[model samples]
Target: MSTGFKCRNCGSNEIEEDNARGDRVCMNCGSVLEDSLIVSEVQFEEMGHGASAIGQFVSAESSGGATNYGYGKFQVGSGTESREVTIKKAKKDITLLCQQLQLTQHYADTALNFFKMALHRHLTRGRKSTHIYAACVYMTCRTEGTSHLLIDISDVQQICSYELGRTYLKLSHALCINIPSVDAFDYLICLLASQYLLERI
Candidate 1:
């Protein structure tokens, strides 16, 4: 009799049965499996789909798997698998900038949070993370009223301004929204408002 087993490595269920029948190896994932191990059909399918989704997310970044999310508690990977690799990469970048530029931790946190929020919004509407990250950084610098030029930010992020500009154009084209012109004066008004609100408290 032939029995089925799920691959622990790749979450693939179409494991082939060996002639010995004592043990099995997953053809898709190359994981060793035993007939005694039982996994629910739903769990196997979910883990498989999750792995595929994460793989897509990681490949979205231009840099090779520099964006690997640690495995999670799901059927195969570790707990961190639920989070996207791009999100973690953004956080690390923000932290590095804060350390190098001597910016306050609060500013770093705010920048990271804004990037996360913007990326999530655009992605849910069918945009890519890499495009969003580049845009988010530009928007962040503008919104924060930093004297640092766009070229400087691009250099620091190791993203070419030309590539980022092209991505911005594509994102704007896809979203059908104009990239609003950033005004340094407008940012000052925002900062003043924030200070006033703090004083009132």
Candidate 2:
């Protein structure tokens, strides 16, 4: 048997499963209905595949280059000597994408670098970047006390927290390990705050 719910938005009779909330959004409106549902691993994988495809689509359209290109290779400074190729995914370009979206390159770069380093730490330890990035960004704003919302991140990355969360789980399973720091986000916020204070004073 199946169950149905009412949308808090338009009171629609039909709702689409909202993977993030573990239920679904209204077919007519886009209101979250269920907020306590857990997704299956299979569905998680499929979402990942879909997100990757979308990322690739965006990449192909953007002048930044094509997606699924297996990360852009570049040298880190000085005269064009030996180059080091860093392999990252289209999702890794969140920083650039966000900046492009907001038209704020400087601050966007700072945020991006922060996310990249923080994400690298988490992912290296066997966590998922997508999830960490989403959570970290949210918590980072909270810590820094900024007013950025998960929706903002969603717009920039073209992925939602629910989807990102699932991706994180799948990536975690594949990596085979668990992250131990729940305070990294707060720590980063404090660190950034202190830096700002120093710059001001």
Candidate 3:
């Protein structure tokens, strides 16, 4: 996440966060930089497509799935879960994943938007949320020119890389999002830099 906050004691950039303790500490000097980090619970599920009439009304002729309720219970990824529950789980998963991948907030938000689009278009039906969320994050990394590879997401999600790639391509085509070709050099640079950091540590 490349936070700009540095330790006052040792002026180190290597700060570790313990979410359980809500503490940001310097790895070099073992000094606490911030004792309180506000973890936000305001999630994407709260924003219910306000004022978008299109979000409310869908033609029964076009809608082939089971009927849903205003309370937000719907079919998603093979599970009949409420909108709040599904989106909340996705929100938490994406947040933790973005942090693990060191993706910026822009990329994270873009990924979440893509997931929302998928939900709108019913692309998530009969699919696994884990794969869908992985695909969203991978698509964000691809479209935003990030150096993260699809295999990275697969490793974290414990899914097959090819399956994840297929999900990503399906979501891209369904959302009509144009993903750019990856630059091998950027990935190489990222890998080398990661190796350097490991050696430094």
Leading candidate by TM-score: 3
Question: What are the per-residue Cα lDDT tens digits for candidate 2 across 21-125?
Answer: 244544332234564565434321246435222112123365432223443453211221111112234234545554544534444433443443343334434
List the candidates ranked by lDDT, beginning with the highest.
3, 1, 2
TM-scores, all models, native as reference: 0.40, 0.30, 0.51
lDDT of 1 by residue, 86-110 (tens): 5578777766765655656665655
Say which prediction, candidate 1 or candidate 2, comes out ahead on lDDT.
1
- Give me the displacement of residue 140 in model 2, in angstroms: 4.4
* Overall lDDT per candidate, in order of appearance: 0.49, 0.42, 0.65
Error of 2 at 105 (Å): 3.3
Per-residue error for 107 in candidate 3, Å, reads 2.0
Q: Tell me how candidate 2 scores on lDDT.
A: 0.42
- Encode model 3's per-residue lDDT on 135-184: one tens digit a residue: 88987888778778877887888887656666776787777776786567
As for lDDT, the candidate ahead, 2 or 3, is 3
List candidate 2 segments past 4 Å from native: 1-92, 100-103, 119-140, 163-201
lDDT of 1: 0.49
